[model samples]
Target: MKKRSLLFGLMATLVLSFASSAVADTKRVLILQSYHAEYPWVTDVNQGIRDALEEERFTEGDNLTLTTFYMDTKRHTDDAWKQAKAREALALIKSLSPDVIVASDDNAQSLVVRYLKDTSWPVVFTGVNADPRDYGFLDSLEAPGHNVTGCLERERFQGSIRLLKRVIPDASRIAVISDNGPTSRPILRRIKTQATESNLNITGIKAASSFEEWKQFVREMQTRADALVVVTYHVVTNEKGEEVPPGEVLRWTLENNRLPEVGFWKWAVEDGLLLSEAISGFQQGYHAGTLAAFILDGQAPREFAVTTPQRGERCINLSRAEALGIAIPRDLQTVTTLFKTQRVVK
Candidate 1:
């Protein structure tokens, strides 16, 4: 009887040790977002990352430790604020020492990734509009050769333009407008190289410096262009150098603009832009998350080539469509998600 009891106790101890070991093997991932938490882009991207991580059996608190930091650059576009946030983020990263990092958008890459390039920690970036070479974070897209690689987000301007032509057969000329910011610079560069409208002509690419300049551009485009391709106006400033509210900017544009506006994001279309086959923010995050998961599972970032997510969503604003008196075809209507009222974010 004593021998049997001794054997049972040893077996129980072994089982407990095995159980603890299995549960203690946790992977930590940190996500760095360029915008605020309340922003739709951040929300969608975070959700996509969560889903992708869960798909790879990395559930939070079970086997995964997931954390996020938002820079809130959109609301405050000054140079001082951006640099400060970048330093703060780097300190947080050092403190946490996460196994993998996912950086979203151009600012995060330019400001944050530049510091950690070719470092020990593996990094996956999403929604990066600028050419990777510009940041010098990796060797190349095909053969990254280093520990940083992920999604390169390019606007599907051709798709959006084609949809616009289908909607408005006579639309011929378009003018692109957005705030003068780091993100818009790449877009303008890409527009010169890739955005070719066979049936329509691109009038110009204008980056507004101030609220007055933004208003002037919108009013001036009424006579010079057929449609306006709006990128982003989050950083537009007022007379006193204060950043104007983006929601206010959108409301004014929706109320005053006569030409149809094409956007490259779902939140833009929902907020007031006439139409867009917007790039899928969700897919961007999912792709980045996938890369992080693979890195956590013993794969190096250099082993995988950089990729661009090709998914897009067709979004239409019903109120804007009705206001402009443009009719979306029956087939197109079936394919799109329409918003009845413009969502004005304050």
Candidate 2:
């Protein structure tokens, strides 16, 4: 009887020990994102988020539980629906109260901030362009002063124009489409200043707030613009006040014209954008993910200043340009990040 009791005690102790170890190994992360379902770049961002968590040894199905909620994929156009979806996501997040919340872009970050700022959960965001100071997310890049810090998707505007010049050797006139958002003004001014200094004929086309206006604006530029430079998609807001993919608008513009479309994201290639001297959204996600994982693993968010990865790929679709009868300059080809062929349905 004593032997039987001793065996039972041993089994109980082993079970308790196992349970403690399992609890210690489990790590949970919640991603409050906006654009994963239909957006190609968000998939890359999700992969980077996974990669970042994995780098910290938090493997999925073993030590990690990643809960992702995409609020702006299918209901991106309906403002009321988008808010309702966000509210539902917030309720779920508030219930789980995960270790960390990784937001992919400015809009996503804003959503998380709206719903989770009062809570103690840390938020690590990527692709935020408006200054942290003005946005109230942090005091400065050197010291975030809050539980929010990640990667910046900002870029060198002059470099992009130089790339455009390289791609279209004889191209001199450039048209910039902007939406007058907080992020657009600085970039427009800086790029315009630099492009003007370089003797490039650049025109800043301020787009209206409506889709019809956008189409009309594009149509107007088609007559005078040598090449179309697509600024951030922030100009193309959905009914929910969220930025929709700018590629569709550009694609519509290019359908009848023969101008080159230069965009910032690699998916722009898939969207029929001719080339990009800009950063890859996947690479940006990877960088952002690394920092987010670090913060989630007990590292302080303010410990790291805002980081901007200068490394980016120069993606070019040679066939895209050729379809428009636009020649790719040799020098531009030398520095091209990606060169591939895709059919334009016309």
Computed on alpha carbons, the lDDT of every model, listed in order, comes to 0.89, 0.70
Kindly give the stretch of ten consecutive residues in candidate 2 with the minimal lDDT sum: 337-346
Model 1 steric clash pairs: none
Q: What TM-score does each of the candidates earn?
A: 0.94, 0.84
Cα miss at 78, model 1 (Å)?
2.1
Off by over 4 Å in 1: 1-12, 195-199
True lDDT of residue 339, candidate 1? 86
Which 10 successive residues of model 1 have the least lDDT summed?
192-201
Model 2, range 1-346, lDDT digits (tens) per residue?
9999999999999999998999877777887777656567678778877886788787889878889888763325455766677777778777887787787766665555645543687877776665545556777888887777777877555666667767666777877775555446666666666777888877546645655666666677776878887765545665675555555555566675466777766766655678776666677777777776787667988788888878777778877777877777777677676556553321
